[model samples]
Target: MQLDTIKSPGGSGSEELVPSRYAVRVGDIEVLVVSDGVLPLPTQMLGHNADPAVRSAWLKEMFLPQKAFDWALNAVLVRSGDKTILIDAGLGSDPDLHLPRAGQLINRLQATGIDLTSVTDVVLTHMHMDHVGGLLVEGVKDRLRPDLQIHVAAAEVKFWEAPDFSHTAMPPGFPDALRAAAKQFTKVYHNHLRQFDEEHEVAPGVVVRRTGGHTPGHSVVRVASGGEALTFAGDAVFAVGFEQPDWYNGFEHDPEEAARVRIRLLRELAGTGEMLVATHLPFPSVGHVAVDGDHFRWVPVFWDY
Candidate 1:
C-alpha cells in the first residue's frame, strides 16, 4: 500500500498514521525528537569488523533482516530560555542517493508548527551529510535567519578540508556523496559557522561537546535543566553498539577510536542513568543505558502517551 498517500479520517490530505515526532520535557527545557524518515541500509553497515556469521546471528536475535534494514534518522529541536536550537539537521534531498524515504525533516518540522526562521542557532554533531543536509535543502538557507550561528567543533571543520575515508567501509557512492555535500554545505554556510574547540553552550543548559570518534569533529549535545538531563549522541552509538561495543561501524573514520568513544559514552550514560538519544536509533530514541555484563544495554523509556 502507498502509506504516504493515505489520508486522515477527516480527509486532511496525506498524513502518516505512524508518529514522526515525540516531545520530552527535560525539567524546564522543552525538547522535541523529530523523525527525518528512515534510510534502508545494508546490514553490514552495522558492524563491518564483526564476523559475518556473528552479525547475522545478532540480526536474527533481534528479529531483523540479515540483508538490509531501515535505520532511523532523528533530529532534535530544543527550546531553552529565549533560544530555539536545532541539534542536527536531518538528511536533505539527495536524488543521487535515491533515498526517497528519507529527508522528511523539513516537511515534518512544518507539520509540527516549527518555522525555519525561528531557529536562532544550530548545533551540529558532525558535518555528515545526514546531519547537515537539511540546511542545504533547496530554499532552506533563504528561510533561515541571516544571523543564525551554527556551532561545530573546529577540528571537524579542519578534518573535512582533507577528509580521509581510509578507515570507512560504506556502500558505493556514499563517500563521494558525503564529500560533495560537506563541501557544498561549507561553502554555503561558512560565514555562519561558529567553530568551537572542545565545548560550547548554544543556550542556557544546552551544551555541545566534541568527542572525536566517528569523525574528527564528532560530538554530542547534553541538555540539562532543573536536575534532569538528556544527551543527543550523534552517530556515536548505534542499535548494535550496546551488544557489540567494540564492533566497527562502516561509517567510522577511525573504527578503534570510535569504539573507545562509544564505550566511554555508554559507561557514562549507564552510570548517570540519564536519558540517551542517538541519530540512528529508532524514532524518538529516548532511553537510558544500563550495564549488561561486560558490554551494555539500551533501556528505552516507557512512552508517555
Candidate 2:
C-alpha cells in the first residue's frame, strides 16, 4: 500500500520507479510513453514451450539471460495542445500477480507531470486485468472516479463488466490472486463507460482500430502525426505469441476469433510498418513487426528513458 520501490533488478538510481519515455510529434501533438512497472516473468512461459525454444540459440548468441522474462506494463500518454489521454491503466495493487511495479501507472503518471483527474480520458484497449487495473487509485475511491470517462469497446463492456464473466468463469487456477489482479477493474467510473464502435476516435490524433480476439472487445489505437504512426496494439499479440501470432492465448473466450484477429493484425503491421505497442510486451513493449519467411518477428523499439 506504500509507494513500492521495486528497483528494476539492475537499474542505478534512488528513483524507485524509472519510466521509458518515447517522445514523438504527431502533426504538432506530443506523445509520451509511460510505463507502470515490469513483470519479471520466466522466459519459458513466453516461448513455444516456455524458453529454451528454437530461438534459444539466438538468445544465447546475444548473451542474454535464458532464465526468465521481464515484461513491461506500458501506458501511453498523449498530449495534444491541452488535451491529455491515457491509453490503458496499469495493474493497480494486484498482490497475486506479484505486481508491485505492475500498478505503478499513477506514479508514472506523476513522473510525466499529468494529473489523473485532468486526464481527459482513460482509454482501455480491453478488460484484461493488467490493462484495466489502474482505473482506480489504490485505496481511494471518490477521489479517483469523479471526472474520468472510461472508454472501452462495447463488447468489452458486456464481457468484463457483465455478470456472465463473473458467473460462468471457473475457479481461476488461482482465485484470490487472480481476483486481486482483476479487482482494479471493478469500478465503472460514473457507472457510465463511453463504449465505441469500430474505427472510433478516442481523441484527436488517436484513432481506434478493432483488432479483437484476445478480448471480444479488444481494440488497438492508431496514432498518426508528422507522417509517423504508432499503434497501441494492445494484447492482439503478445511476446512469444507474436513469434507465432496465429496461436491464441490459453484463455481466449473465443479462440477462433483470436486467431483470426492475430493474423489480420500481423498482416496490417507488416504491410504498413506501423510500430506496435503491447501492454504486456517485453519491457518497453514497443516494437515493429516484420515478416520473416513464414513468420513474424518483434523488433523491439528499445529506449533509454
Candidate 3:
C-alpha cells in the first residue's frame, strides 16, 4: 500500500504514517509508547446510534476531518526490574490484513534499540488483530524467542476458542479472518500462553484489570509506581467515546455493557488523575480524561522531552 499525504484529523500530525514513539517514567519503571501504524476509519461507521448530524457536528466542533478519523495502533513497552514487558503486540507486518497504512511495529521496536529476544513478556489488551498482530513476524519462525510468555485474559481466550463463538457477530472493525487467525495464533503458542482471570499483577507494578464489553474478555493494564499511575485504557475508550462515553461503538461485543464500563472507567480515571494510555487515540496515545459536566474530555499529554 502507498502512503498518502493526508493530514491527520486526530491532531497528532500534518502528514500520514510519520513514525512516532514517546516515553514516560513511572517511578523506577519506564513506559515507552510506540506505534504499529495508523488506521483511517470512516466516522459514519463508528457510533451506531449517533445521529449523522450530531456526529458531523461533533467532528466539526473538534476540527476533525469529516471523512475519516485516524486511529493510532499504540502499544506500550515497559522496562521494570529485570523484566522487559510489552503491553500490546501491534498489527504485525502483513499487507493481507488490509491495514494498508499499518504494520510498522517491528521496525519501530528495532528503532528503539531494544532486542526482540530481550522482551520477557507480551500482554494482550484483547484479541483484535490490530492489537495482537505483532506477536510474531509473518513467516519468520525464529524472530521471537521460545521463552517469551504471552499473557491474555482467560475469559477472552475462552470466548474466542468456543465452538460457536465465531458463528455469532463480531465487532464491526474486526474481520472474521483476522479473528480466526488470532485464535489459531494462540493455539500455536498454547504452551507459552498464560491466561488470567479477574485483576492480577503479572509483573512488578504492572497489573491487568478486567474491563469487558468491548470484547468478552477485554482488559486494561495498570502501571503504578510511587504516587503516579497510568492505565492502558485498552478499547474501553476510543474516538467519539472520549466525548461521549455513553455512546456505544459498532465494534462492541455487548454495546450496553460496553457503555456502562466505559462511563464507569472514565469517571474513575477522571477522579483519580491517572494518565490514560489509549490504543486508538491519536499518536503518542498518552493523556488524561476530564469530567466535563455530563460528558468527558480527552486531554492529550504534553510531548515528553
Candidate 4:
C-alpha cells in the first residue's frame, strides 16, 4: 500500500509520512510532544560500563542492530494557564556532526503552529547540545520574545563554565562539540537565564527539579494538576534504563550517579504510576512504569487518538 503524506506547514516543501507530534493532557495542562528527529549512535553508548556480550545479547533480544541504532529526540510544548513553556529545544543544526536528521525541532515547531515568540519561557533540563541547540539555530533567538525567560538550574549553568568529561564515555568528537555548544548557548543567552537553586515552577503545576546525575545540573520537569501528573524525565531515563538501571550511558557526565538517579526515578515512577515522557525514548514517548521483578517495565500508554 502506498503511504499517505502531509506537507509540512513550515513551507520547506518537505513531506512526512508519519506524524511527528503527539498531545497529552494532564488535568488542565496541555502537553505536546514533538519529534526532533533521531540520532543514530553507536550501541556502545547505551551502556559503556556493561559487558559487551551482555549488551549485545540484550540488543539481539530486542531485534536492534548490534552496531548502532536511532535514538529518538523529543521536545515538549506545554500550555498552563496563560504561560507557554518549552521543554528542551532539541538539536538545532551542526553540520560538522554529520547528523543531518537530528535538528528538525525548529521546523517541526513551526509546522505545529507554535511561534517562537509565543513561547513565554523555555525550561532546560540541561545544557546538552540536543537540549539547547534549537534556540541557537539561526533566527531562533531573534524570533523569540526579548523578555523571554529561560529557566535552568543554577548548578547546571555553573557546571558548563568548566565542564568535566573524565567520567563520560562518548564518541571522539563529542566532548569538544558538547563544550562548544554549551559555551555558545550560555554566551548568547546568558541575559535570559533564570537560574534556580533546586526547584522552580515555570507555571502553575509545572515544576522543574534538578536531579544532578546526568550532569551536575540536569533536571526533570513535572506537570501535576487535579490529581493527574506526568514527568518529562530529560536524560535521566532511556529505553534501556528500565531493564538495566545500573548501566551507564556514555553521554552521562557522571555515569555512576546517573545510574543511581535513573534507578531512583524509575522506582518512584513505578510506585506513583504517573506517566513518563523522556528525550531519548521513542516518539510520543508517553508511558507508565511498572515493577518487573528486580528491575522495571515500560508500559506505553495506548495511543489516544
User: Candidate 3 residues 101-202, lDDT tens each?
Assistant: 677777666655566787888888888777777765664337777888888889888877652333224435356656665786786778888888888787
Q: Which stretches of candidate 2 lie over 4 Å from their true place?
A: 1-19, 42-44, 47-68, 139-145, 161-190, 302-305
Q: Once superposed on the true structure, which residue ranges of model 1 sit more than 4 Å away at CA?
A: 1-12
**How many clashing residue pairs are found in candidate 2?**
7
In model 2, the Cα lDDT at residue 220 comes to: 87
Pairing residues by index, what is the TM-score of model 2? 0.78
lDDT of 1 by residue, 1-305 (tens): 11122222223463788988888889888888889999999999999999999999999999999899999999999989889899999999989999999999998887666788889999999999999999999999999999999999999999999999999999999999999989999999999999999999899999999999899999999999999999999999999999999999999999999999999999999999999999999988999999999999999999986
lDDT of 2 at 21: 49
lDDT of 1 at 29: 89
Model 3 scores a C-alpha lDDT of: 0.76
Q: Rank the candidate models, highest TM-score first.
A: 4, 1, 3, 2
Residue 187 shift from truth in candidate 2, angstroms: 3.8
Off by over 4 Å in 4: 1-12
In order, how many clashes per candidate? 0, 7, 0, 0
Q: Each candidate: RMSD to true structure?
A: 4.1, 5.7, 6.1, 3.7
Candidate 4 lDDT at 245 equals 91
Error of 2 at 194 (Å): 0.8
What is candidate 2's lDDT per residue for 1-305, written digit by digit as tens? 01122123232332554445455445665666667777665444343323346557645755656866567678787765556777887777655445565677776655545556667777888776667767655553444546566777777766654323321122244334434444445554536478877768767778876666766688988888777788887777776565566543444556567767877888788888977877777556667889888788888765534
